[model samples]
Target: MAEHVLEMKNVTMQFGGVVAVNDLSLEVNKGEIVSLIGPNGAGKTTAFNVVTGVYAPTNGAVYFNGKHIVENYPRGKMKKLYAGTSRGVYTKHIEPTPDVITKLGIARTFQNIRLWKSQTVFTNVLIAKHMRRTSNIFTATFRLNRKEEKKQREETEELLKILGLYEVRDELCTSLPYGLQRRLEIARALATNPSLLLLDEPAAGMNPQETAELTDFIRKIRDDFHLTVFMIEHHMDLVMDISDRIYVLNFGALIAQGTPEEIQKNPKVISAYLGEQE
Candidate 1:
């Protein structure tokens, strides 16, 4: 049996009268690239937000590396939040904030480019590497952490080379071409040494050629780093080319899920794309 890296069991997210993700459950096994796809307003990004701890779920649970990371949704006025309750959503749990989850081997890139504009590509990635630094401020200021800092710089440099950003290492992050900037964001996430990577619309705004390059890049990174990826994407070609499986959402509900070939032929997915469903 495959080891699961991430699992969402009956996870739902609600805001007053709106349910952003409706009892959606899915799993990504270790070393697989899974994609979430849907039309606009399909709740794909919302689901990502939930997984990364931007918003707590209204019900259900999420697990990372076989450990419960999110559970026990408290509500003042929730009706469906507890529908079809199972064993228990309660467990020894800590509110898994985004940074906390990142430390637990998950790292993510946002839909918009979020690089530090004034910082160089090298520094941007180096900053992410600092997340795991152990030296206290006293040691760091006194150069007691010199050895660790040097090691971190070397690692970040190697990562930049792998991502093909080494040549522009000294360039301001915002000055790079759009595609390279996107790659930099990913590199920053990789610096955190995550087992699972979440990419939001990685192929957005890319031309055909750039998108194709990104497809290859994603596959290479996954193979090289032994990563399991969960991405939210709209570019069908990119999603279909590299995903091990695809989950399609419609109006915050999972409407279809399968291999690329299967999802491509699904009637519900077809209808969602054509906007034919009412």
Candidate 2:
């Protein structure tokens, strides 16, 4: 059996009275590609947010690499100000900040393109490497640690090449085609050197052909990077084509989970997607 890289136990999130995720438990094993699919507002992104520390679950716990990080890091200055405290307060066992969770070897891409639109593609990816860099900002800015900077640059370049964005490395992100921009986002996430990657709607606005290419690209990255991927995507074809396992969510609850073939035949999934069509 593959080693487990992520585990969520009875995770539930409530927005006032509405439950965004309810008693959801799932796992992703090492080097596996898992898909989270559901109708809109099924809490798929909510699950992603919880796992990545965007929102602490209203109930339950999440573990990454066998350790709980839902509330592991110190809260940032802003959170401190808002909460009227400087000391990091653990909220329901959740980590106080997303940065700490990320440092634990998980990274994510947003549903909307979150690239620095003003920056060049290379610059966007280069910035991601900052989180993993050991040198202080002073050294990085002054080029004081030349060896480290060189090593980081080389790694960045290789990642860009792998994502096929090396040719447009110097171009502004806003100027790239939408499909390339999405690829750039994935490349930037890869720059963080994560053990687990959470991609939200990676195929959101691509043509069928582009989506097909992206399917292959995703698999290639999984093998090349040796990382586990948990993705929330609405593109059924892409999800079915690449996922080793599929988890179906509806009304903020998991309704079905199985191999692609099994999920395709699931009555609940059919009802959710097709809505009991005549």
Candidate 3:
């Protein structure tokens, strides 16, 4: 039997009168590379935010690794204005913070590169390891946690070397080339020791060559780290080349999902991107 690493059941996000994600349901199996593709403003990022606990859904629930992580149903004004089904299906309202999600073996990179502007590449990756420290304030403050600190630093160095960033470890993180900066952001996420990795628009703003490099990089990391990858990408070439399966979203709702070949022949997907032919 296949193990599911992430599952979103009937998830919906509504703000005032706008429904950003409607009755979204998806699952990612362990070790599979899944891609979500859509036009701009198709609620792709909203789905990622929901999974990362940035915004709790207005309806339904999200499960990570077979355990329910966040759940909610309409309440008060939301109940009356709710446009989605499954309003009363979930009895409890559960919302976890972003940090809580990160600590739960899930890590992600933003659509835009977010690196520590003033920090060296090594320091940036090292800072991500701080979350895994077992030392309390007193131990950390008094340097009593030197042993643990040293271990973390050693691990960070190893990661940099493995990712080919060791050559510029002492350089400013933001000073690297645009593609390298994106790689550094992913390295920071890896520093968190996550089992599941989510990447948003990883190929954005890249030329053909850099995008191709990223495709290989993503596959390398997934295999090397034993990670399950879920990504939103607009680069159809990358999506078609790399994804084991693909999901299509339009106007905040899923329209199709299948293997790359099936998605390519899907009429609805073609119509969504090209519009209905008269």
Top candidate on lDDT is 3
- Tell me how far the alpha carbon of residue 173 in candidate 2 is from the true structure, in angstroms, after superposition: 0.8
Prediction-by-prediction clash tally: 0, 5, 0
Best by TM-score: 3
| Per-residue C-alpha lDDT of model 2 across residues 1-278, encoded as one tens digit per residue | 76889998777776655667777889999889999999999999999988887887666678888887663222343332232121333345554467877788999999999999899999999999988878886886898888977888888899888789999999999999999999999999888889999999999989999999999999998998988999999999999999999999999888999999999999999999889867
Pairs in steric clash, model 3: none
lDDT of 1 by residue, 1-278 (tens): 99999999887777777777888899999999999999898888888888889888777788999998887464555644444333245443345789898999999999888899999999999999999999997997899999999999999999999899999999999889999999999999999999999999998889999999999999999999999999999999899999999999998889999999999999999998996735
Candidate 3 deviation (Cα RMSD): 0.8
Comparing 1 with 2 on lDDT, the higher-scoring candidate is 1
Candidate 2 accuracy as lDDT: 0.85
Total clashing pairs in model 1: 0
TM-score of 3: 0.98
Cα RMSD to the true fold for all candidates: 2.1, 5.7, 0.8
